[model samples]
Target: MSLFKLDNVIQNYAWGSKDSINQLFGIVNPNHEPQAEIWMGAHPNGCSKLGTTGEPLSEVIDQNKLDVLGGYTAARFGGLPFLFKVLAAETPLSIQVHPNKRKSELGFERENAEGTPLNASNRNYKDPNHKPELVYALTFYKAMNGFRPIEHIVALFEEANITTLNIELNVLKAIGDSDALKAFFSAIMSLEGERKEAALAELYAAHARPAKTVMGREALQYSKEFKQHYNDDIGLFAPLMLNTVELAPGEAMFLHAETPHAYVQGTGLEIMANSDNVLRAGLTPKYIDVPELIDNTIFEPIKPEDIRLNPVLKEGKMSYPIPVDDFGFDILSATDESKAQYLRSAEILFCVEGVATISSEGQSITLKPGESVFVSNNSSVYQYQGNGVLARAYN
Candidate 1:
């Protein structure tokens, strides 16, 4: 099979942040502090073209008869199974939940029957597909990734002296308690003016005070920002509020469908199953589907640390600390010319610094800083010679 090189496109998404003064250093950064997207795969919403000539990747592969990228992806994933994006959160994203396969299928049909456009911002069922996502930190990335276990949040609420949120606390006490959390979310999301405003005032005050736990500190920090973006969004009081994660450079996290989450701040490399079905609940002016988010989301409290991936190892020739089936990322830093371990799958190498040459099957490509290349599966035994850092990804 011929190697199908990737055409990396630098896209500026709107969700990016201005306060992130550090993540923008040295890259071809957006002056408007726009969210940056480095789309490496093909998903029609945005697919990287072959070159500046504007030929779509789907068309290129269709004409070439190349076995490097499967035809299924060319049809379904729009030419690539993975879509890599660099998400830099300028402001808080909406509190949202994705629909699982069954739910998405049903919802898509229901919405279609109701005559909702596929492109409408409020349309939660864009497709009947489940999106499982993974984020690798380019810098320190912070987010609320999942449902926090109720007890932890209850404890946090107590430590912060915000006793008024007890309506949710009592709900969790019931047996088969999922509905209680759902009810709490509905109450908050559906609530209006004065009553909700008073509740937010108390919650905001508690989040301001210092508490002993890590969750406590995170709660206070994020609550201030959440309030800044959404003054009285009742969803701010959900149990998911208690869990906030911050990932350092080189770390990663995975989020499956129906995992209610919000990207809080910082820059990172994100890849997901190719779909965009987000049902939002706050912090932004984007569409909010209160009923959908309430029904689809899970309300348990989560510890920020649980989503973090521990470094596996850095031994021998490769540092293969990060792992995923869709793609595996390896950090390579060579002090001298060295050969990468041979593998069965197709791979791509991105040079981080200095100069490096990848050669296999008598074909070679020279890579410099910010340059990457797709390696044929038949060209697995390549020698990389230089002094620099690199990331190698393959299926």
Candidate 2:
């Protein structure tokens, strides 16, 4: 493989902050401060900065200027379907969902039939693909994953004395499974006037003090945002009302298609299968296609507390987890006494910490903090030498 540097994009979302400095050591400190996303993938939206010839990434990749990645990624993903990013969410992200490819094609076509612009805000379909994401937390990450079990939600609604939400909850209880949950979500999204207003009132009445102090405050903040957008969204009460999961550094959660989810807060390195089709189910100001979301959602009640991971090893210079083809990343830590291990894969390794040197065959490169390198599948066995942390990505 030739020597070509990745072009990284820096994004400053609301939920971002720095610990000691900004983008120096990848040491992200969150206090509701500005954060940055270092994108090193081939998505048109944002691409990493190239090392040579100060130019946008797309130009280099387009002209086959980067001899290393020219033919590699394109052949694998059939045109880089995945967008690699590191998000520092100091504030809770708007609750949203992605549609599967099937749903996207159908929805895009349906809209075309109705004369909506292909890039219209109301256009929910971006492409024909399902996005399954796996986010491994580098720092402590908190997010709401999956739906709250219908029965559990029903019980919670009753406990809070939420008459309006409870009425819908009861209806959901009668239906029992995820499909019923989908129906319930649809009803909430579509109902207007008196019924919607009544539902909102009940949700507000049922709002509970979040046991997690920080998140509780955030829930209140989003509740206000929800009111501003939907006016009477009963789902506003949903955040404080559902289960929340806090992942310690190194843990991860996988969300398959139609699994209702939301990232409440925290910062982390996120990876997903190559796709961007989302079908939101509220918690956002984005387009909410209630009927379409209902049709595509799998909806069985899922709780955030249930997220888990299977840790493989952590004693040596590195740790490797069970690999699933979409993408795999492992945390690499080194000590003075640690010995470098050989690595060779159709992958990209990123150094997020102390200095380290990666050598393969007879070629080698030293990666400073926040720098990364791409290793071709044809590359020889490689080794890491230094004291630091590294994350490797591959399909």
Candidate 3:
């Protein structure tokens, strides 16, 4: 089949919203479960099934890699290189960072040699691939991305009179900016016993008063919200340390390897390399290997302009250009009949809003909000008719 309607899996993580998916897409949820993510890919964790044949997408792709993934992608990546998802975060996600390709490969191999089971809760790397993802906001999405500049970070702590980090802050002031940032972060993560608790308490008390500055207000607000959920986790200090971002509808952010980030709230579409390797720091009860996380992470400040991935209009579609070859993203909107180019690689087309029909190879498939179809590389050129907003993912 050139086009297969996809039956995806919705992951019910504890941080998910109870009604976001249902209210946004009209998906049935009689159980009122928290729907965290709708996975549309061939990952072993949650492989999509073909609606017509009930065959697993991964097995089907293995049957005909070249036809399904196209020649270059097949040879380069050996299979589908990307995973797509609709991620909804009602509460804060873990403050985490992904390993780079080299680190992930080494970690995966080392863990295998150590006889650590793949399903082990203490496992740090799940696959040998790096996960660099883009989050396209469907609603007002809030998140923390990367570290703030050294001066800004110092200013906030100083203004709040947070003496808990007196020694670390002094080191930051003593050393150069770049080296100091990493050392300070490592120190913060390694904080133990009364030191950790005292710091959290001091920070909490500091935020009790209304912020006196703009940045201060943002930090205090996020810190308070996070403390509500994770009072014990030191990650509540993330807002004061990392860059806080709130993307308006239609805006997007790209998170690369070695960046410390977390999805605070709201809904978005996420596309990434087919990898599950995540090394967490805080804001979670999960096992955290602080040294491993610090070793793999790149401690650098990301400018505000660099956080959001600006769209480049190309051939009637708004393309989100990424640095990696594992995936590509584009937003296409049509209110009338629109002709599109032939498939260059395997793709998943998701209708974000309105109704539309995809026609190719003498066949047609109608898609509504929250519906999607997998277009194999063998499919002929396709066209869309009717009103809709579609997100197309390809390599």
Best by TM-score: 3
How large an RMSD does model 3 have? 1.1
Candidate 1 stretches with Cα past 4 Å from truth are 1-7, 17-25, 29-35, 52-54, 64-66, 70-78, 161-164, 173-179, 207-214, 238-242, 300-305, 314-328, 341-348, 352-355, 376-385
Q: Predict model 2's lDDT versus the native.
A: 0.62
Model 2, 1-395: lDDT tens digits are: 43345657666664455442254555445653565566766666676555666565555445552243434445654543355667666555656666765776677677778887767888777666667777777677777776666666666556545566566677777877766666666766776788777766665654544423454555455565456545555457655444567788778777667766777555566777656567776656667777767777776655545566664665553343533345666676655553444433345667777877777767677787767776644543566778887776665
Identify the runs in model 3 with alpha carbons over 4 angstroms from their true place: 174-176
Model 3 lDDT on a 0 to 1 scale? 0.89
Worst 10 residues of 2 by lDDT: 64-73
- Candidates arranged by lDDT, highest first: 3, 1, 2
- List the candidate 2 regions with Cα displacement exceeding 4 Å: 1-3, 15-33, 55-76, 105-115, 208-234, 240-242, 303-306, 314-324, 335-346
TM-score of candidate 1 to 2 decimals:
0.82
Q: Candidate 3 — number of clashing residue pairs?
A: 0
**Candidate 3 clashing pairs?**
none
Ranking by TM-score: 3, 1, 2
- Per-model TM-score, in order, reads 0.82, 0.80, 0.98
How far does residue 239 in candidate 2 sit from its true spot (Å)? 2.6
